[model samples]
Target chain A: MWFKYIMVKLVLQNVSTLRGIVGVLNDILKEAKFKMTNDGVHMSATDPAKIIMIVLDIPRTGFDEYICEKEVELGVSIEEFYNVLKRANKGETVQIENIDNKLKIITTGKVTREFVLPLIESIEDAPKITTGEFSAKIVAETDIIVTAIDDASIISDELVFKATQGNFEVAAKSEFHSTNLNLIKDKLIDLNVKESAQSTFSIDYLRRIFATSKLAPVAELNISTNHIGKFSFSATDMFRMYFLLAPRTTD
Target chain B: MWFKYIMVKLVLQNVSTLRGIVGVLNDILKEAKFKMTNDGVHMSATDPAKIIMIVLDIPRTGFDEYICEKEVELGVSIEEFYNVLKRANKGETVQIENIDNKLKIITTGKVTREFVLPLIESIEDAPKITTGEFSAKIVAETDIIVTAIDDASIISDELVFKATQGNFEVAAKSEFHSTNLNLIKDKLIDLNVKESAQSTFSIDYLRRIFATSKLAPVAELNISTNHIGKFSFSATDMFRMYFLLAPRTTD
Candidate 1:
């Protein structure tokens, strides 16, 4: 039998943050693997198409009450979890429990609702990613990137990120239309570049990464010319999420 | 030549009202026929499936500036019109002009956007609807009906509306679940029933009609047992919309 005792119980005062996190994760991957430890909860997954990888960490302090008896990993359907969270009001308190290989979620609002989702076996382990020497790094408002991506998406499928000593620009162009957005040093929280670097990435993946904009106010971007890029979005002290994407060559 | 000069030019201080009107119409019909006159703009259509008919009247006072040189009827793709409106900020002014068999929409906000959509010939004339004497009438908050319809939709494809001397109730039941909502006389603006009346209607049509809830505060419901029903939603003096639906007989 796969039945087991209750291993993890978490209570959240507000479900908005969790909703935001799950919403972004669902956009990147259909299923997610959640690791619960004494320290906090962690989840990471790569898109099935192998274009983007996302890592998420939520500290114990982020939850009102988090209890984990032992280190355990559970597999959850990101889409189903997100749909259940949609039922919760922003101010509602959410309670989650793991029992007998099933995950139970309870939300307290004008009316209390409960949902039980069966747990599946975890997928293959996440790949170990190594960092590459980046030539440019910039920290800017999340809205700046999100809005630019949205605007560019209207015209083209690919967007270019150009970084220099003084400015970071996102531009996209098609045969008939083009959009260019510039973020100067004055608008960035931090900017560092040894030399100018430009790279293009798929706008589809960028949009999924930017879905976290509602949860965080700022995002740190690290890019190398014609290589992979990383985006780290931080939401105050609540949580931190990282996204890594491969760049498309100019061939 | 049909092309002579601009026939209608309208500037709206806010595009939200127009968005609301189009959103609901799009759900009912794909193409919409709009009739422009000196008094205001009018649109009426019956669903392609012939299940429901809707009529919209927006007065001249609703617009910041309204001009009409001659009466003209234009056919527009509701889905395309909605996509253009989506670009306008809720608080932004939208200027619309009909010129050379095309509708030009300009929205001014933090940025200005212009979209030109070609107008097709009117599809067909709106049928004249003669409503029978209704035995039950109730005026209630739009949100109440919208919420009840949404809740009932979760369990059944049809919902029954029952009106007694002092209470208006919306109820739906399936094999496994049921929902009942009651709006008493005290909670309604007005309620009048010569005798008890009950009728069932398709939730699909109800949802499309209630999509205009955000545009109006109150809806006047008129119905007779197992007959046709009319829902009249009015937003202050800006616009008035009427939805007529044929009830589904239980037999």
Candidate 2:
């Protein structure tokens, strides 16, 4: 009932993608689709396994607003709330409301603590942005490039993706054994080649990029020389993901 | 090389906290740490704003003994290695080794996953055979009892608690505006009320009985009530914990 902060209506997009993926949603929410709206942030996802559509809503403010009217209680906070919701059951009760100027949130089956945050300008410019021209496209001479890298990536700490005029490959080295796979076929996704360009990316973000296989799909490209590369994603939030490495000098 | 199903060893005692805290570790390890060990598990923890710990390790079987005379490269199963370590760090290099029969786990970063677990067999069947009739002690009973019933607890779905006249009072409630300060009072250690009479406990174990406090720290109690209570824990994998409620028809 006590009012703390007020704000004018402002709407913005929210998107996020998981840096690493156990599933598709993790990839979409944490990496590519970062969004934030006036009402709050929402994640509209479909479980690849069950193939069930999920619509999740998180209010903008972190407070509990109750209607002495209908008997319902909900709570949420900005800092840790998202982390909690990320793990909550899709169908669990999630509550949010605007009382006077304060917003309240609540989640079922968990204790609640009211956190009143100062509502700031819900402007679009405040979010971190990535400003760099990215290459429009590249031809993967070999189709096995990404698959090989991702496959070998399953064993090594980092994926050494190499692409060039004639060959493309992904490889990982360990004290016990080194894994290297070649991509000599397929031009749609992987270009048949020995090597053209090179870049080292976090398997985490790569996992996310792969998540978009169903949407905003990215075509394959072979990295010829090992060079650090960058990628950006915008939705509710903006991200600048970086991958670094010297070209695969040996292989 | 030969391949076999991948198996990693992880030993964590105390499953009670896993319901709430392990998720946090899941996030940090995704990029912060990776690896497994033959000896057990090891990692590094830190106070960096969002990051809590960095875990790293290798499986005991990962160590290649065939190249004993020379510095040999380590060979790890693709999916097996990825599946095991993916649960830890998302982007970091992870190494694991097995010497002899035991696995030795090591990682790069602050080691934080550490705790002592109480086994039910060791804690249950005895005070050399636990006796009945007693008094339970507490540091500040008013704080726990009063704060428990406040409006903050209105959203607390379950208020499961058990207490004896003199021994101890433990409560866990999953509701909004909840009063959990006492249930997880990380401050106090042993409350001297040891007049063991009767006690009531909560069913949900996610609610911490005492925050980072001692587990099974014996307290005296004056059990005069007609209710049965239980505190069950495993010695080997303190991970699985349970508290049963005994309806107190008579006080």
Candidate 3:
């Protein structure tokens, strides 16, 4: 007789990246599915209205200790997971263990905290988002984008992103007020505009995307004419988050 | 011809203390009455339910510049005042000038911001709380008290304070859980108990009182057996806040 033993445990030295990723996911989706394998962990979810989809991938090298004998899929409530992760200090290590049907989270800081979260049913058929060629690709500091989104949110519900020659402008207009933030080529790390593309999106979605600004110093933007826009935020070699947002037309 | 001139203006080195005091008042009461005299500024308010009363006093010496030709009383919405002050940086100097019917607040920091708040009719006869002799008096670090209150709040709706010869204890007991925090003589600056006394008060009131912990380092507690309790949180000689809470019977 032959038997195979299965062990699934992951320990991360710093929880800041995980916390930042979970914070953004909780804002976009209610429930998220995590796939843990020998390689690493992958999670993705779409908003209820299907306006946005988020994908998170963390390689095995991201964690201090990653042990997996067999692949396992865990369904979790993102909000609850974020709340539990919040209990860990910025520099503290977090140890996660698969216990029967619950996830055991052990955070070591000034005091060790143990939290057990019940697993939910994973979404078997999550919508797959395809990456296509874009007309404009811009790379800028995350802080600049976050600040622009925040300023635009105060004036209108919709924000327009326009990339022209050597300049990327974020603008919002309403009956009462209007705000415009212009990022010149000198300020941005990279700017590529094939034919000058502009798209309008809901400020609500953009604000949620900026929630992960702490995870990375900069964000790479891939903007298509009028279909979809993608923002990729990556931190060193620890984690990478992708936010896909659907464009809105001003009718 | 005889003319009388009245001018009331106060400039503080930092708005943090003022912000903390206003934050506590806004939670307890909707409107507050501020009286400015040669000595300083005094404000007090009672909760809508009359379960708690808060008093705030800032001496003239606390302000960088205090100019008051005649005593003036201004009625303000505590929430609005707090919201305006929130725009000021932590260490930014705030200049408050009574201009006709509005209070002008100028904050000097990275950017100068000016906000005008309309003054309303002052509450002429605000209820005055008399400080009575208490059976037990204890002084301890504000952080310890605040943490204990936060911990107790998670377990019960009421917290009991008991002071014996050399120990001060804060405990919360509920049907589901109980939490006790004891501060011995070594940990406290002063602990006096003429006779052992115990009192229970609503955790809701205690939590609001602790919101001002950032304004002071130590908090002085005056406990009168089963009657009322007063907590005085003072920051150096700049400001002092007093919170009087009505006790509840466990039975």
Candidate 4:
């Protein structure tokens, strides 16, 4: 009974859901601490520079099986975890458990494969953000934003997001070249504007966050002038992830 | 009229076919000379180490449009050409031409994009391979071979191929681990062995050569003991390419 209380097991019917989540977190954090509770799994971490913070919550209903007698913290290298998940083929179920301070990942498909990675003690403190009241919010197709990011990336490394009552625009510029993607209200899934807002962010961070677009079809964006911007992806109620990025002050 | 005679233009309906071809060539040669005639395009080059040679031929009938007044050689960096081809989206039409000693690539789909690469002088002589008489030939599903290579790569850096009168086998071994993929006569599309043979080759080379599995469904392998092994991939008579690798003697 004591050993059972200390152990936790999670089974995911489709590995890609977890794979996509870790892929996004790996971009900003080299290591992450996952808090497993009866409710679900949650992780919060920021980049070394504190320019980006990611918060993830996957409810217990999302997993095929979630067993936890007591809350536990599992800290592991994001890189190693990602590498292990890469070995899981499509339609494979992934089983994760901890034994003797080592995390074991077993994928069951046509054949079963197991990978073991050691857990580490995470001491880094999570950054606290006092978010400002957002003035504008826009929901757009994930693929469209990914395309816009790629198009602007060819011109500059920084991207500017402008939201007006009529439209939302993503623009980038260099010395001689500039590209802009304009999406009108008719093109978006939803649009809300209390006041017009504009902000600039690093394309590098934006690209990595959006790389998980395949996991979600739509993205919800919240912005306030000269403040942190929040971009979130979610399914109906299974999982939700939001990334907050600080804007460039000079822009 | 003279400019027309000196210039040649080629158009491919699907960009991925050429993309896949150049992707394989870029693995071995930095620069290569393309001989363009009314009949087709041919390229022959060997790695700098002279341990592997690749010969490629894409017939004129493979293209949607092919124009050549006279046979000419277009020499360019294979690396750069491969990079440019990567930009072409799926289902896009790729058009290539030579203008003022510069090679021009244009892809037409949602938008027309053009890229220019400088032609270089290719002075390296192609390696002549008097292929040894092959005693064993095996044709298997490209995907199966790819999986076998990936499995063996996990245990060792080199792979061994064994053929007998009844079956063909791919095997690899390390100090503590070993993997083997055995295909009997019924398992393979075709297997013929005049005499039993065993050979070893660098897994690094085999991996790259097999990366083009997406371009073809079946792969034909020809091998002889202690000699060069030839692996070829093609789609009927439209195009054919083969890789010849010298086997390790000490094995």
Candidate 5:
């Protein structure tokens, strides 16, 4: 593979939320860790419930010319960098350099305004989310399964992904609302599951996938009963993200 | 052209403010009137002192497919029609039409929400702006001039556009601020001096141009002693924008 970007960056919850306009980027990237040594930026930011790591590595090289090594405590100005790169498109040429404590990003097309991301202490104090035993991996069997389930969850605030003896179903119900989205894996991918486990999570968090639709080629989700779960996708590039949500009390 | 549209709306202001978003639109497309016909709607919102205009136009072809004819009103929600065509981009395919009391708008892309503008009756009354003595025509050559001034009237809340012989200059001065932005032109387009007048107006009203950088491709402006001016920009489309202001007592 041709080396493009040499550095990496980790995106956090609060910094991204505070800066994410139109709310598109927040949903797609979510909780992830990005490591950058000489390519892009190696930094992290978060709030109470999410942890995100962002890596700013280009598909090409020349980043080492400007990369600077600093302790993790020297938080990267995610907002400024994002705004600078925000003017750029996917394949456009962008050169990022650390000049005099300021990150300078230059895009190829119409010269966009210089963005300045202020360096501040990383707000890394989020709620500790830890889950115990979780076992269930059902490769997306068909397109219909993901679509139906995703749609059904739209109206309800929570969703239940259950893996039983031979059937795997994602469902939701309410007085005036009810949705049953199912998937039969015998005809599709490899399915491995023993005991039945049904857990509910906020659809608000689950909606993150739709935001990254352009880049999400594959999705691997890990779930449980009490703590947060993980949802990851690999599109043109590899992306790993997680969401830790506390389950609601049963009635 | 192929016809289509969901709804067409018109909003007018009777209460004139010192600074409003729509004022900028008048500066761009000088004498252009917002046309709300069967196909779609087109109007520019500007600030009162004439800086920019937020010009929004949704064509009928951008919608799916629908058509009908009826009297258009304001504020009422044509939800179904609005929802369908809300995602229409600047140059998207639209098909909007009226059927009975319902409006049908078919949009090419997915829509999250719709926008509706209020009508003339519902909006607060604005100043009654009328045609002035120099409201005639100007010779193309000598009529257009704009200059970005430096620290002259830095503290003064007003600027003066004085016409002498055949030249015009914008000047401002005060203890805290003294600056002038002047533009000179004299080859052609002639100005009819309404008794050779000068007026002082607030710069705050001119800041709204940030929203509208498009509509005012070519425009004509008017100035008087009382700080009341009329700005017009037109070709095939016609519009007359009025700006009312009290002259600053900068003695």
Candidate 6:
């Protein structure tokens, strides 16, 4: 038991990366299982309703100090972890260690603060998705998508994403108000269309997912007709996050 | 009735001044009666609990366009007025007119937005306080008091202000922690101690009042033993706001 407790210990030069990751996870999950391996820390969780799945990876190289004797799983309340991380100030170093069913977090700066949370029993592993054959992929500046989402949210709960041979569009319409954002291939960072496809998704989920858009400047979107939409972004070189959301059916 | 409708027509070059004024009033009164005269717009109201009285004055010179054919009493929900003012973008001009029984608020920018709120019957005029002779007065940088309030708020819901011949102190004590901020006469912008005095006040009220400290750079405080405390600040040259708060009894 003592040896197992010492197996996983890591220190982050800055807590913001983990904070952003936890912010995204906490939006879709109450509790999450994080797997710590020699390579990195990883988590894949699906909301209870099975409408969304989030996969996160933070490479071991990103940590200031990383030591893992063997692979280990740490299950914790995401909300609690996020709350503790939020207390960290800029330039503070965050240290994490596992000891006797407790997760210890220490932040060192001008002042040192420590918080502890009891670890819970590990839940069933998250099911991984075999990447589907997406008909179209579009890459755009994160601000464009974030701004489009904000504009659409003013009028409707769902947004329609359309990819055609020459342009991409995000639009929403209610009985009284409508907003449309059209980006031609020349305007986007990159755009690929095997065949024209359109999908509608909940603005609620997109809003939560993109809340951390400041962590990354660009996002890649994969979509197909009336199917799941996959969005991916890398925060600096430290970590990458992926979100899979099921599309809403339009009558 | 028709003549009264046209009596009050005022335009503010920048809505931010009124926004800041309404922000402070809305914190204390849900429904406020604003008296507009050729001199300016003024309001004096006491909280329902009678624990705090706020007097606000905005001179006619502050308004970009002041056309008052006659003095008019406009009574409206402070909350609704505050919400509409919040919608104004920076540099947007705000036009206010008493039309019939409604208050018309128009914001002109790149886009023009208009909101109408029905006027309600005016409440009884606020009771004016005859200035009292305080034994001590202290003038300090607003940042000092604002910071002191924030520090005390972490420990207790009430703060004790002690003024002596040479210095002044703001302090709070809780079961586990205590915070004290001591400022000597030389450290303050100005300090006058005719007779030493001490008073305890609700931190909740101070916190709300000081939230608008950005609008003012300095504040003056008057205190007497176990009596009302008067705190006043000017939000730029546009307005002067005074808060008179009754002290909390101490054992």
Best by TM-score: 1
**Candidate 2 local lDDT, residue A114:** 32
Docking class of 6: incorrect
CA-RMSD of model 1: 9.9
The per-model DockQ list reads 0.04, 0.03, 0.05, 0.05, 0.04, 0.03
User: Compared with the true structure, what per-residue lDDT tens digits does model 6 show for residues B86-161?
Assistant: 7666877888888776787777754444566767785778887875799899998989999999999888999998
What TM-score does structure 2 among the candidates reach? 0.32
RMSD of 3: 9.4
Over 4 Å off, model 1: A1-251, B1-4, B173-178, B182-184
lDDT of 3 by residue, A99-202 (tens): 66667677665434456677786566578778678889999999999999999988788888999989999999888789999989999999999879989999
Model 4, docking class: incorrect
What local lDDT score does residue B215 receive in model 2, on the 0 to 100 scale? 33
lDDT of 3 by residue, B1-251 (tens): 11133267889877777777888888888887888999999887788898998888999988899988788888888888899989888768899888777888999978888999988885655687776789999998887787667656654688889999998988776543355667778878899999899999998889888887877888999997797899998876788888899899856
- Per-residue alpha-carbon lDDT of candidate 5 for residues B106-184, written as tens digits (9 for 90 to 100): 3333552233332232432223444456522222211222222212122344566665456555566553223333333
Alpha carbon deviation, residue A22, candidate 6 (Å): 19
Judged by TM-score relative to the true structure, which candidate is superior, 2 or 3?
Answer: 3
lDDT of 1 at A178: 52
- Which sequence of candidate numbers ranks them by TM-score, best first? 1, 4, 3, 6, 5, 2
Model 1 reaches what TM-score against the true structure?
0.56
- DockQ for model 2 equals 0.03
Best by lDDT: 1
The lDDT values for all models are 0.86, 0.34, 0.83, 0.85, 0.42, 0.84
Query: Candidate 4 has what TM-score?
Result: 0.55
Residue pair clashes in candidate 1: none
